[model samples]
Target: GARHGINMNGKLQRLQEQEERIFSSSCENLVEQIIEKKKKKKRKTIETDE
Candidate 1:
């Protein structure tokens, strides 16, 4: 029974780790997207002024 419990706990830990990795990657992608949007807007404004 102890071994079974340990196995279950390990499985839960792996799932939690995977979820954290996924969440961080999603956050990074969102940040990159926002940065890209700002850059594009700045480029558009510069071109219009020229």
Candidate 2:
């Protein structure tokens, strides 16, 4: 029983690390998309002014 508990705890730790990695990558992708959209908006405004 003790060994099983230890194994489960280790598994939980690994799962948490995996979750963190996925979340970080997703956030990075979202930030990149937002920046790109902002760039496009700025470009559009500049073109409109001209």
Ten residues in a row with the worst lDDT in model 2? Answer: 1-10
TM-score for each predicted model, relative to the true structure: 0.98, 0.88
Q: Write the per-residue lDDT of candidate 2 for residues 1-50, one digit (tens) a residue.
A: 99999999999999999999999999999999999999999999999999
lDDT, model 2, position 27: 100
Give a tens-digit lDDT track for model 1, residues 1-50: 99999999999999999999999999999999999999999999999999
Stretches > 4 Å off in candidate 2: none
Candidate 1 residue pairs that clash: none
Clashes of 2: 0
Evaluate all candidate structures by whole-model CA lDDT and list the values in order: 1.00, 1.00
Clashing pairs in 2: none
